[model samples]
Target: MNTTILDMVKIEVTKLLAVGIIYPISDSHWVSLVQVVPKKYGMTVMRNQHDELVPMRIQNSWQATRKDHFPLPFVDQILEKLARKSHYYFLDGFFGYMKIYIAPEDQHKTTFICPFGTFAYTHMPFDLCNTPSTFQRCMTSIFLDLL
Candidate 1:
């Protein structure tokens, strides 16, 4: 399915209105995986600049084998967009680390710093600053790319 401009505007407005409100999931059979796709391409590498390993872009990152009604691109897209807008696109957290998947033909020697240590390998590209504004800029880049 294609994304619409109005849809994106609504999403942004919603997030702006709801900053710090996390909902709790209460389902015994609800499980999902959040993948982190690096903006850059290549092998995992450490980045002292960000003080952590880079993470890859989230591709098939989130998975829900069985659930009541799992949103397809919406879920991932929303989270990813939020991350990007909130400067958490790299899936950076303080719990675990992410892994890297380097393609043979890839040639981008860049790495990102997972915000919360949620990945194994480090092969994501990151810009300086790394703040919510930074994430917004990144999100804009992605939108432009899609166009």
Candidate 2:
């Protein structure tokens, strides 16, 4: 039996969910976050911070308008710290690709839509408003004793 495009998309998405790459979002609105893009292979879409599908025209607009005021460490400060250490051991967190568990109560806020269905993230998504700060906080909490 030949699987239709929707069926194929569903299969791929299901695999992603099974592996903890994504989670289901129960109370999701279609119009708010689901945009269907035309593709030959299968369904494709752009997920926004609210886990919504972003239309092409509005996607750029949204990105340009969003403001993140979270403060990052100054490069000079980091450089000074590094220079103080004679031997520096670098632990790569894969460019800050750390796994951050999402709170159960707030998981719904990360819901997004695909061609087949809606899903939420079990781990922190990079697009969240305060992801950098949140990640930094987590790191600080974990390494406080060591530091």
| Tens digit per residue, CA lDDT, model 1, 1-147 | 123433443443344225421112233221222223223563222234333332223337763212222222446676666765634334452211112223323312231112222221122123212222334444456566642
Question: Model 1, clash count?
Answer: 27
**Count of clashing pairs, candidate 2:** 3
Root-mean-square deviation of every model: 20.2, 7.6
Instruction: Please write out the lDDT profile of model 2 over residues 1-147, one tens digit for every residue.
Output: 135545655775687688786776667432235333445775454444354333222343464224345566677976787788777666544335338777877666667765567787677755565676777677767866744
**Residue 11 shift from truth in candidate 2, angstroms:** 10
Clash pairs, model 2 backbone: 23-120, 33-52, 33-53
Top candidate when judged by TM-score against the true structure: 2
CA lDDT of each prediction against the hidden true structure: 0.31, 0.59
